[model samples]
Target: MTIYGYRIPMMASLIVWCILWEIVGRLDLLLLFPPFSDVLVALGDVVNSRSFASAVSITLYSYAWGLGLAIVFGVALGFLMGTVPVADRLLNMWVNVFLSAPLSALVPVIMILFGMGAPTVIVTVFMFAVWIIALDTRAGVLHVPASLLEMARSFGASRWTTTWKIVLWAAMPEILAGIRLGVIRGVKGVVIGQLLVSIIGVGALFTTYSNNFLMEHFWALTLILFAFALTVGQLIALLEARIDYYAGARS
Candidate 1:
């Protein structure tokens, strides 16, 4: 970032926000916010607790399963929609609707179908993530050069070989971009699912903290989730950068 003709590090903005938060918290301007330093201390304490370990394990388990399923099905659906006009015509409207819909309202329906506990949470994450991934993948596949497909076929490449080796590879950048977005959405899904379904995992801790008015601990937990989401996004963005040549190649 630039300020007064001087470039500032990206992290400077975060530090500034933290300072402001600290000042406001110290002044008791907001009942919900505790001093940032206290939150940091709470962070250390929370991390060292056994309950935190269990919560992390449960959250990660549900998240991994849901995201894995979303990736598998989302990519497959997208590939179908991209290649087959019939499938596109049939599914595209629903995909767009789900993408724009208020998804949280659908969680209760999922809970009814999947029942309580981790299953519901897993489904929630899948529901939250899959649509965007499918949409992006379809867009990527659609953008693949027709010339590439013709060349592959002329060279006697089998259908599977053409799709797996050429089409998917060409579409890697957008697929990864979709997956990155899906990861962020999946985090929200897992949190909300746990909170609404059965209050297991980090949701349980959140319940305890909020109900007890442990603002510092609550904020610390929130920061951990924010950090996780940002870290995953950066990692995927790095992967996208590495394969950006595919986008250039497409052009």
Candidate 2:
């Protein structure tokens, strides 16, 4: 970030927000926002509680299953669409529709099919994340150089070998980008799924806190979710940086 021709670290912006939040909280400017310090204290309490531990375990379980399925199916679908024009023509419109649609509205349909349980939440995450991943992967695969494909063919590489070695490697930067985005969307899916389909895990905690007007605890929990999403994003971004040479090679 920059101001007045001087660059500022990104963290500085977050610090400024915190300072503002603290000031507003101290002044009791909003009933929803308690003092930042109090929320920080509540954060510790929330983390150490047994309920938090259980919630974390359940949430992680659902998240993992959902994201795993999304990756597998999404990558496969993307590969198909990218490699086969027929598949692309058949699926492209629906994929774009789902990607642009209000996915939250589909949660109730999922719940009806899967019932009010963890399965619904898992399916919700998968639905929320898979389309974007497939779209990005298709884009990446489509961008793989024709020269690379020809080289693989000249080397007498089998179809699977060519795709696995040349195409996938070249397309990896965008693939990872898609996965990173999918991860963030999956978090939202998990939260919404749990809240609506089954109030267990962190959703339950959110309910407990909000229903009782535990604003500090509510904000603390919100911060934790934000931190988790940001931390995952940063980790994937680092991985993207490491593999960025692939993009440069493509160009």
Candidate 3:
């Protein structure tokens, strides 16, 4: 009755790891690393703190908005580059330049320009993450098999029709992979932006705790961020798995 067979084992492994981590942390051989129970208590405290809730909400909001804008423009630009040589030529240099540059260093510049807060941080994250999505999508489109295109065209498929029907379907696996990578990088960029450009988020809290040598708080916040990233990554994997199953099995 199962549509796919992989989910149960993966979920079991995740649960096992969490249990093991809690047990190990509770043993507490390391003075600096607090028990998982303590971390949970801290999480509860942070969750109940209005200031922490507000900061977390702002961070999440900025992350969603920035990532959304990136996807919109990135996908559009990617499609344009795939279809138009001039678009690729005009964009290639700048794209590479931005990608190659140390964008984390320019957080101060972003702060100066945008004058602090979520606006600057979100922009910095988008700047760091968008190029990967655009470039990968463009490459995926270009590398699609010519035979597929010809077949679609032979059926008198219009330009738009071919793009949507054949090109997009073929490129989806790769495009989704790019999105997965971009999302992870975007999360990291958000943390970096929060630390450097603003004084908020788990990143900022982690910095403050570490600077004050509050190892328990530092590690607790870090664990939360790690869990967040892992959750996002797993969601992306689930999406990709679903896409592959639908596209591959529907002969």
lDDT of 3: 0.78
Please state every model's RMSD to the true fold in angstroms. Answer: 1.0, 1.1, 4.8
* Candidate 2 lDDT over residue span 131-247, tens digit each: 999999999999999999999999999999999999898988888888899999999999999998799998899999999999999999999998998899889999999999999
Q: How close is candidate 1 to the true structure, as a TM-score?
A: 0.98
Q: What is the lDDT for 196 in model 1?
A: 81
- Give residue 246's error in model 3 in angstroms: 8.3
Candidate 3's displacement at residue 242, Å, is 1.8
lDDT of all the models against the reference? 0.95, 0.93, 0.78
Q: Candidate 1, residues 1-251: lDDT per residue as tens digits?
A: 79899999999989999999999999999999999999999999999999999999999999999999999999999999999999999999999999889889998999899898899999999999999999999999999999999999999999999999999999999899999999999999999999888699999999999999999999999999999999998999999999999999999
User: What lDDT would candidate 2 get against the real structure?
Assistant: 0.93
Q: Which regions in candidate 3 have their CA more than 4 angstroms from the true location?
A: 1-41, 245-251
Better of 1 and 3 by TM-score: 1
Provide the TM-score for each candidate, comma-separated.
0.98, 0.97, 0.79
